[model samples]
Target: MDYSKLLSKTVVDLKPSGIRKFFDMLSGLDDVVALTVGQPDFATPWHVRETGIISLERGYTYYTSNAGTVPLRRELSAYMKRRFGLSYDPMTEITVTVGGSEAIDLAIRAIIEPGDEVIIPEPSFVCYEPITRLCGGVPVPVATLPENDFKLTAAQLSAAITPRTKLLVLPYPNNPTGAIMTAEELLPLCDVLKNTGVAVLSDEIYSELTYGVRHTSIAALPGMAERCIVVNGFSKAYAMTGWRLGFVCAPPEITKQMLKIHQYAIMCAPTTSQLAAVEALKNGDGDIEMMRAEYDRRRKYIVEELDRIGLPCFEPKGAFYVFPYVGAFGMSSETFCERLLNEGRVAIVPGTAFGKGGEGYARISYAYSVKHITEAIERIEKFLKTL
Candidate 1:
């Protein structure tokens, strides 16, 4: 069987996810304290879960319209407006997706064409670059520095833009690094993008998990929404990762085309999940607050612990992960993580898994309970002493 010849060359060439590699390694080990994945440790809010249960009990297991139910869309519309001051027509401008990941893929595919270029800021979530490549679009990675607090600057954005540039992925509050772009920080980049004919995919799945300051969507900025697709979901905020539901909000013209892809590829998001999401949007504010407060506590503890142990972590203001520098140990990010896993029994992802920009750092997720995080920190500290 000549499987190599038969398989899609692009899929064959694409590297397996770096984050998942460490996660998979854990399955063979016992008694290891792992902080590799970024899923919330909290359960889905009881009310939201109850809603899904009720929908199932009522025999609501049927397919929905390709764009999802009208009621769910309306709730999504209201939720966006209430939370971020963004407006989208429920009927024509919003399409529910399998998850924020799917929303990202749809937006990129809907816009990117062969030979186009996507400007991706690295040390980010691992999806953007590979997804762009799968679309036959070239990925241009711009390394966001720790000195800049990992935020992408206007100068960097300007330098990356070319006539071939077709889209820019704005991932914040970011994964792996936990960096965020405040309105003041985003304004300069927005100004640079105003006439560039480049669309923006603003992945804000962590919107409700920020600390000290609220999240500001790039689409909320003046003149930006017209060219931006806002991707968000119930995963982080509502602890609904298993629900497998997310949504995209964009201009009608853009969504009209994205829907065609969704109709053919997905048909619709899960019916039970969509109905449950309606309840989440309408009544899950308190759930978000409770979980976020706990995450904030964990965030502070992890950052302080890393610094105390001489790892020099960047204090993350958003998201649930911290990217701590591991270069002082004179080991590659992968080697550092491998040693931590094998010797310390504490698992974390290497920064190089994200991109070249992540070469000297490693990501530690604070999405676990204080006790779980404390155990991992102790193991890490013990491992550092061996250095």
Candidate 2:
């Protein structure tokens, strides 16, 4: 009769996502200018959607190969090289996953042993540490600071590692903080990583949305191609979140192991999404450019407005979220977000939902319309006046 005793302790102890609770609260409110989740407001590019439509109309709905359609994988390989200078063999080094979340799970489950440590930078995507724990690995969080623009320094990484560190999660163009690692910024960390027998799980889903600087994949660094798994998807850049598609790229040995877990657990990725992904890679660059321009405009406007409202915000260089420090008002991040939603009727995620490093901050997604974001900012200003 005791459910707690019957369930796996790991699953029982895992906390549900903090982002969703705010989303659920906002869903019931009327006239709310909400920006809690990172769901991109842009429509999925027509060409990509049309391909999915055509596939469905033609009844091309059979399951894809365990690794995914060869055509799609080939296009992904080409896209990686074109966008980020990363190289991989489509047939042997990439496996299409249900989404980037699954790729993280597959990568962690494939490599980590029971006591292995997974070094994750705090203020990171929420899934990494949880998935690591579920896979029986220890989650070691290294706090990335606002003073350093939230980028994990070489000293932090050096200190986090031990003989048992099996992996390092590199989530740049990061979700909550929107911090990015440039090639220059990554050099010394790469130096530190070079000596350790650790694999890098690079999450670059926002790679296509960077403003001025192109994203540099750790996989492309010298000797890194052999020791990295790059996890990415159509969710953010292409506004294809509903498609439920993503992929991972690694060396053949790692790919082979991850592919096995993916095969047994997932069988294959969705067929329609696979076909559409091929179209996306081939013809979606223009769409990415258009969306990126709009996001850049909104990103700038939001940062300026937050400062004018007396909330200091970090000018995020990538992704569509801005992290603003909310501690000066003498409230915790959770209380700030809760009060903001109930009083201001504008929903934004608390940064501590990400990790402890996010204690004094709140994450505001700018993926909504400019008018919508502007309105949210106006309401937020009035809320602060009340505080």
- Estimate the Cα RMSD of every predicted model relative to the unseen true structure: 0.8, 1.0
Residue 102, model 1: lDDT of 93
Tens digit of lDDT per residue, candidate 1, span 18-49?
A: 98888888889999998887899888888889
Give residue 127's lDDT in candidate 1 (0 to 100). Answer: 93
Mark the 10 consecutive residues where model 1 has the least summed lDDT: 36-45
Q: Which stretch of 10 consecutive residues in model 2 shows the poorest summed lDDT?
A: 20-29
Q: Quote the positional error of residue 220 for candidate 2 in Å.
A: 0.8
Per-candidate TM-score against the hidden true structure: 0.99, 0.98
Model 2 CA lDDT for position 283: 89
Clash tally, candidates in order: 0, 0
What tens-digit string does per-residue lDDT give for candidate 2 at 265-313?
A: 9999899999999999998989999999999999999899999999988
User: Over all chains combined, what TM-score does candidate 2 have?
Assistant: 0.98
Alpha-carbon deviation at 30 in model 2, angstroms? 2.7
